[model samples]
Target chain A: MSVNILLFKITLLFYSVATVLYLVDVVRRKEKAGKTGKAARWILVGGFALHCATLLARYLEAGYTPVANLHESLSFFAWTLVGIFLLFDIRYRMTVLGAFSCPLAVILMLIGSTAPTAMKELNPALDSWWFPVHVTLAFLGNAVFTVAFVAGVMYLLQERMLKSKKFSALYYRLPSLDVLDSINYKCLSFGFPLMTMGIISGAVWANSAWGGYWRWDPKETWALITWFLYAALLHGRLTVGWRGRRAAIFAIIGFLCLLFTFLGVNLLLSDLHSFKAMEGP
Target chain B: MMNIIVVGLSHKTAPVEIRERVAFAPTDMGRPLHEMRALPAVAEGIIVSTCNRVELYAGTHAPEACVGQLKAFLAAYHGIPAEQLEEHLYDYQGEEAIRHVFRVSSSLDSMVIGEPQILGQIKTAYGYAAEHKTVGSVLNRFLHKAFSVAKRVRTETDIASNAVSVSFAAVELARKIFGSLDGKKVMLIGAGEMCELAARHFLNNGAASVMVTNRTLERAVKLAEEFQGQAVPFEEFPQRLHQVDIVLTSTGAPNFILGQEKMEEVIRQRKNKPMFLIDIAVPRDIDPKVNKIDNIYLYDVDDLQGVVQANLKERQKEAKKAEVIIDQEIGQFSRWLENRDVVPTIVALRKKFEEIRQGELRKTFSNLKDLGPKERQAIEALTAAIVNKMLHPPTSVLKQNQETASGSDYVDAVRTLFDLEIAQEEDDSELS
Candidate 1:
């Protein structure tokens, strides 16, 4: 196997181990199990380092950004998700969140690994500097939205437990509603702006490369729809005080729309931005 | 086997009159703690006195004798008759004693389940005992374990997460809405007793300032002065509503005072910042329809009471989980205590065997004046082998039984059969 493949495997192994440890700590719910959470966080950091190495090695071998294929883009997406989650873990000190998020990262990596790992040449249309800027901002926004999605799910679960007056193990392991809500708000505030910039940058790149700023491509249309959904969530939260259950439900919906825009438009629908290099000629 | 004992009266077992009488003053704790440690059987002692309970936790070699002495000490300390105190006092020993301390420290046994004060009270009690030099190694380890167990229960269970009183529930709701009250403003309308109490709860929780408004200008000024707040005329309060984040109203008005239309205008003027309105009046000063308005939340007396009741029920459920945690910790501590007995028994048994071996060797050596040095060493080795061969079975049995319920019984049987006299002072050093 190549060095990049070896690094990818090592990253996957560490992420899997961290996920198991986090799950065990969440299940045991004992004070002694706290060490497991700390260990899991350190292991995740190691995995993130290896994941960065894998990306760097791939970039060197491909002679262009490696995100021209589905596998590379998914791997990059998972890396960004883990990066954002680590920032939250440090700020909030909620280790149980790892139990919720690390598995999602692992799943994304697993899906990414299943795709073809062969390097592909970038399309001539994608060789502009705007390519990297637009893709990075888009993935970073998705990563923030992913954290918000997890927090939203946790908020709904915690709210159900509190409202039903059932103090289950999950209830104790999850943070309070206030904490979860604040985290959701923080993610939205950060993600929404980045998303706006990504769309604007995409428009500029399209204008430069395609001779027009507007496109009726499937991907472009879905991206607009996803942007509008998040814009409405942010606007309602600021002006109409949409929060708690309403905010949580909207965040989950917005994430689904984002997922469809990112994956569904690329795989199922014909689009101008499909990165045809992934189609194996 | 019951080395730890807890003797006390709490709100559950005694009335406030009796609890107050038995409670030890902090300034006077030194004499009582000293007297408790001075008791013959008590190796270590701590006296925990609070408004809700007065408990004496002691570590001792003789559980029964120590309990008797503590009972008498309590009678003598307060000059209360032994019979009267006996009716109110309760005692727990052995595993029961350890579990009681764990539960008490975790606030499972508080008058209001999950109240946070009892843990601090116990910590203060332990502090006094340490300062008086009454707590030895055994109690030092046990109390620290209790503290960690309490912390685990707090983090691993939602026992103390919710507010169980009306005033506290209001504060909790405010926190839920605003996340933090550091710079939040509070306004009090008409100054009913319950409203003032809830306002004080908000202030204690970190509200920046309070504003008071009543029908009578002098009364509003007086109430505001007491709270170190600003006084506004009752009629002008609505015009200034945008300045406050929380509004508590409890007036004698027969109808809704703060209606939906007025609140909608205020919400618009405030730029839709979230507002919490607690209508504590019987007729409800704030209109119920206002609850549908965006950025406005209103809870009346019944609503707060409903929250309190639900929170109380949640605490009761969490208490069961806390008890399970205590049981697990007690099992661990009890194993340690049992292992403590095994060491001394094994030491004493080994000492007895060695003594016999040495005595026989001395006799052989005296009779063999003409014997060679090699010959003397051979006889010494043979005698040592005999002792070891005889001790191997029983020593293995004792070691294997250390964690079982019958471990202490086996330890006592061995001590009695061998006529072992293990010095108590020697074991004290072993613990350290």
Candidate 2:
């Protein structure tokens, strides 16, 4: 009903339309160049711009970072996901990647829209420069993992089809195991540092505000768990040469842990990071 | 009409032994061209000789006699019995001949339909004929049209874009896995011909290097020298497998040469870099379970065959589109051929009338020597106009019928009635 919500809906529209265009290209392309892929990418760029405006508008109006509640967090998460996907798309030119990622972005935006979009008052203890820095880094890491998760699923699908000789349209549409594995490796190498920095920044902020760095909060513990899962996967890949199906399966598990840490911990547990739970519901 | 005739034995009609015997050497096509030109019915001739087909495209006056004579000449020139070659040779005349050449040039008639080599082979055949002064106006025009039609089919359809052979299909799969074949290493496990062929395909697709390993070290060295690669001793190939990205095995062994346990160790040694293994042997060299190993993909000959078959089906769909283009182009070329026949008759008819007119004018001019230069120019213009007017009806009729089914009949009547065939004969003789 409000202007920022209006902007959010328009952003959602752009992403949904982009999703459809990407899917159409995915279904139609047989290793041939098509206009739909390029069009979808441009439209996603428009959506990303509008999503940024929506976040900025909320920031200016509410006088704090926009990602303080469930609705804002999901919207910001989808926004960052699209930003990372576009970066990878520019590098890879994998139309199927857009076809997979844009739909996920659209679905997240839709679910976020279902939650209340009221501009809630920020908790006084949480209103600090560390809030934006910590959230942005964490969101960026999760966004990179999101793309890696997509690539991992594609790897498993392609490997199964090639091994069982039961090929589908997806088998032809997906990239090779080598390409998918490399993408996963790139994401982990890059995402790991951002996530580590996010956790450390959160610790610094927590120590300054709450008189402790490592509080045994549910969100903190879950974030640490997610970090360890990805850490083990990374260590295995580097030292033991773990790759392909085994690596893809672990990346998927690591991504699931990340999703829970982002959403499940905040919604289900009474923690200092639970913004919605602070409103007594 | 100009009778385009094709007399040939292709892979469809003849065995390799018979075809190879009848094939003409491309390096020395001069003698054959001279011999074919001397044939009673063949006006112009071009011979296309490839490993798959040996065909003679000839412009002829008598299609029936030309077909038999070309067949006989093929057998006699090759020192084979006429009866033996007769059963293998096939002939086409008029529209059928044009369609046959078009299909051959488009690669639709190839043993592997849609393969690109046939078009280049046809161009080389045309080049030889052009150099020898064998193919004249009709064949030169027709072959050019054939080339353009082939180009049309290539651009309008996707027939030649997909891999429909085993070796090509393997390369296609490798491309999908590696995204690009640059700097990748290929290994051939044995000295089988198919294995060598697959290795060549990989090299052509930009595999950085090749390693050859055979049961016999001498043979390995010989094969490796030909490919300009290293010959790994058979005993050391297992240890060297880690260096290769693609492995092609076609040994005549009874048991598996590459077991799952060995492949696992090899993948580890390669530092989880993916390996594409192709077992070209009937008794599979690599164990099937190796396919289940991470970063290791194994395909036997049957799997490659499956890919080839699927790609063949896709090409067939594209080939149908090519056929449509061929059919549309045939109409334009057929009209051109018909117009060619009518054009000679019309030219000879006009030339006969001009000769008569000039003879009469010269006599008139001598008698009227006092006539001015202006009057002489006026008289010449008058004669041209009258001749054109007198010739208009029959000329229009010939032009109209040139595109019809009865076009040849009208041309023959005009040529015979005016004795234009004699004039055309002289014209052709003077040109030759």
Candidate 3:
């Protein structure tokens, strides 16, 4: 295996270790378990460094930004998600958030590693300056929404535990509903714009490459649909005072649409921007 | 042997009249604690004087005399007749006493099993005892151990993790849904007493404000004044439903006061903010279908009762687990007590060796011709010297361990090797 693949595998190992430690912290809430949370954080940081190294190595070898295939897209998405989560961990000091997010990173990395990773030549027709910008913006937005999805799920769990009046260890471990709803809002505020910019930039790039900005490709159509879903969720939340459980569930629904746009579209549906395109945007 | 003796009356063992008369004021604990320590054979004392129980924990070398004096002193100090209080009083000594304290501190012995307040109450009692300087090393170590045992039961088992009352269940449910009740508004729809009490529970839990609406405007104003909240006209409450996060309705309405259609309009008007509706009225003020709406939670009194019942069942299970933990702790604590009891353990070991030496000598004297009294004395001296020499090293080590409170393993090993419990039983039988 090449250095990039080796680096990616090590990153997965680090994330798996972090995932286990985070799960321990989630379940066990003793003073001793606090040290476990701390250790998980440092391990996650190590994994993130290795992940960065893997991406840098991939970019060095592939002669372009490395997010051009399903495997690379998933890996990059996981990388950005971990990065965003670490930043939030710093601000929130929420180890339970890590419990929710670390397992997700490990799962994403595992799925990304299963795809065949042999390097291929960049396509001549699709190579452009806009490719890296569009993919970067879009993937970053998706990563932010991924966190919102995690927060949304946590909110629902907390809501049900409170609503049903049946509390578990997780209920005590999770942050308050206000904190989770605000996190959802914060993610939406950042992610929606990044997503909008990515779509617009994709249109601009489409105009440059295909001589039209308005082709109804499957990826484009689903991205638009996903955008509308998030748009409505955000609009309802801000203008209509949609809060707490409603916002949490809406954020979760929006994430499913976003996930279909990113994953289901490229694999199941034939589109202008499939892995078959060779130089993915 | 050092004994922990408890003399007390609890909600289970005594009527409230007896308990209230005997209950020691926490502020004036120093006087009673001082008097308890001054009692003969009572080495140290703690007075745990909660509403449900008033227990006197005494560290004594003479459990019988100390327990008797404590019982008598309780009646004298409270000016109640000894005969009147005697039937209500119960006592436990040694292992049973420590186990009782552990169970009480962990809330396994509570009136409401697994209620959390008892632990804090015990801690406060312990603090008062410490402040009064009445608790010596044994009671001090024992009380701290009880506290840690309570903490162990708290973390290891979910004993005190749920609400057992309807009002508390409502507060807990609201907390889960809204996270913190801070800045959340509550609306009281009617003047029913249960509804008002539930509203107070919400207010106390940090719900930002309360809005009262009754069919009678004057009564609404009166109830609103008590809550320090604005009185909403009954007709206007539905229009203002958007203003509050929690709505508690318990009016004597014959039919449903709130149905799905009205709630849908209110939900829309509120812009999909989550709302909690607690219907405490017997006739059911809110339609059950309102629960089907998005972001709206509806619970009647039955649901609240169900939550309380389930929580109580869970607590019963947790209480069983707590008893197991306390049993384990008592075993460890017994070893700790044995280790700290250096002088007594030393005396017991010496007695065991002496008894063996005398038994062998008796057998020797029976088999042989009478060695003169001189020879008999010399043989006795030899055995005595040997026993002292053998015990000196381990005995001195055990003595040195007195300050550090270590050597429980050594103490336990010695007890097991010597079969000390058999010696204890014989000693107890002789004393009786």
Candidate 4:
């Protein structure tokens, strides 16, 4: 295999190991072994680094942006997930968010490895700087929602554990529900603007490339759905005073839509964007 | 079999006066525990002492002997006669006793349902019993299982969520107003329990500073120290109220403490800043008319009650989901227990029939010494089938009967009838 494929394979291994370690930490209720969650974070960071290197190498080899295909988008999505998680940790000092985000990153990376190697050649209409900017911002924005989803899930789990009065092994290790809820809100706050920018840029790119700004393509439609859901969540929180579990649930559902857009639409359903289809090793 | 019984009064069945009469102080538990254990029918005993209720759980061969002894012990402990104690005490025996332990551990029996304090109290009782050597395998297993079941209930149910007390509700209400308390200022008026609780909540939420003022300076200082806040003099209340974003006033004062004029002046000085004033005192500390101010949100005891009621309603709604989860968890645990009950019999039956087949095979091999290897193998297969056919019915009967109450009797009967007693003893030895 080539250097890009080799690095991609190694990143997959790193993610699988990280998932195993985190799962063990959750199941065993070991706060000490949760320190291994830090090791998993580092492995993810390494994976993210290799992932970036592979993307860069593929971009250089193909003489265009590597994210023009479904497999490439998945790889980029995984890379951006770690990027967003690192940003969250720096801003909120919330390293515990890794337990959720890392597995998601691994899933995206595993999906990325299946992209057919011969399909790196971009279609004639895809050759522009706006393509990279629009897709990059979109990837980063979705990554933020991914983090929000993780926080939302943790919030629900922690809330349930607390409400039931079962201070079990998982409960003590989890961040407080309030903290998770706040982080969920924060991720959406950071994400919504990036997503707006991505959507606007995608519209501009599409107008220049395809003669119309909105084709309601599967990717575009799903992106709009994701944007609308988050937009409603933000509006509800600010206007309706929707706080805590409701907000978390909305965030989680929005991310699910985002996941479907990234993985499901491109893989399960063939579309005009089928050139982005990923193939397994 | 001798049964362990638990009988007593709780906050529900009896008034505080009667509960107090039977209540065992933690320091006083050891003496009654010894007295109960020494009774003719009592073999072992444990005393669970709490502020709301006191219970004596005793294991004894004579269940009726435990009743009179418990009544006598309560009478002696409280300096009352047995007849006076009899009116207050309720009794539970056998399965009811086990159910009571489960209920108590799960906090369903707590004065506040889902309060976390009961589990710790139950564990403490277990520890005390272990220390006094009053617990044996049966009671030990029973209580341990109760603890596990309690844990399961908590994990699988939403019984613990949003069941906020007055103090916590005050805090939660304050949080909804202030998005984040990271740098908010709070003024706690008086050193009452409500004030202390509100102060702790603010401090926990990252309040920048808390100024506690009371009619007495010493009490204020002590309450402030507990929460790592500052204690200001009562005279500074009006001046400090302007500076703080949130004011929690809970005092023993018999009348309205804050006049309309004073609060209006403070609000004017604060330049229309949003302020949350919680009046938790009985006679109402903050002037109710101050609620007229644009940004002044005044909540008296009634308002707090409303909030508490709403939170309880929300909890009740979520509780349905939690109940379903708890029921699922219980089902899972029951399945595991059911599987555990049948495991030994299954192993015993399988081992017994396998042994019979091996014995028949050896006898066949001795009888067929002249047979070739291929012919001998075919004979062995037929011999094994014959042994299996003969044992299948009885062995399956044993397996099927394993979950019933009479399962052990069946095992014993099989051991006697087939001389499987030697095999059982050998298995027992292997287990040991």
Candidate 2 C-alpha lDDT tens digits along B36-59:
878987878999999989999998
Tens digit of per-residue lDDT, candidate 1, span B26-62: 9878899999999987878999999999999998767
lDDT winner: 2
Q: lDDT, candidate 1, residue B232?
A: 99
| Residue B277 alpha-carbon offset, candidate 3, angstroms | 1.3
Per residue, candidate 1 scores C-alpha lDDT tens digits across A1-281 of 88888899899999999999999888753323488889999999999999999999988988776778788888999999999999998898778889999999999899988998887667676578988898999999999999999999998887665444344666547775668888989999999999989989989988887788878788878888888888898998888777777788888999999898888988888677675833333
Q: CA lDDT, every prediction?
A: 0.85, 0.87, 0.86, 0.72
* Candidate 4: docking tier: incorrect
Q: Whose TM-score is greatest here?
A: 3
By the TM-score metric, which is better: model 1 or model 4?
1
Report the candidate with higher lDDT, 1 versus 4: 1
Interface RMSD of each: 5.2, 1.7, 3.1, 11.1
What's the count of clashing pairs in each model shown? Answer: 0, 0, 0, 6
Ranking by DockQ: 2, 3, 1, 4
Q: What is the lDDT of residue B317 in candidate 2?
A: 86
lDDT of 3 by residue, B285-385 (tens): 99998987877889989899988897788789878888998899898778767644666677778888989999998998888776988998898899889
lDDT of 2 by residue, A151-257 (tens): 99888888887777656656666777678989999999999999999999989988876889997888899999989989998999999888888888888998999
The segments of candidate 4 whose C-alpha lies over 4 angstroms from its true place after superposition are A1-281, B76-79, B173-184, B189-193, B204-208, B213-245, B250-300, B311-432
| Clashing pairs for predicted structure model 2, backbone only | none
Model 4 Cα lDDT, one tens digit per residue, B122-194: 7898788888777654466556767776776676555675536776766655554454667888888875766
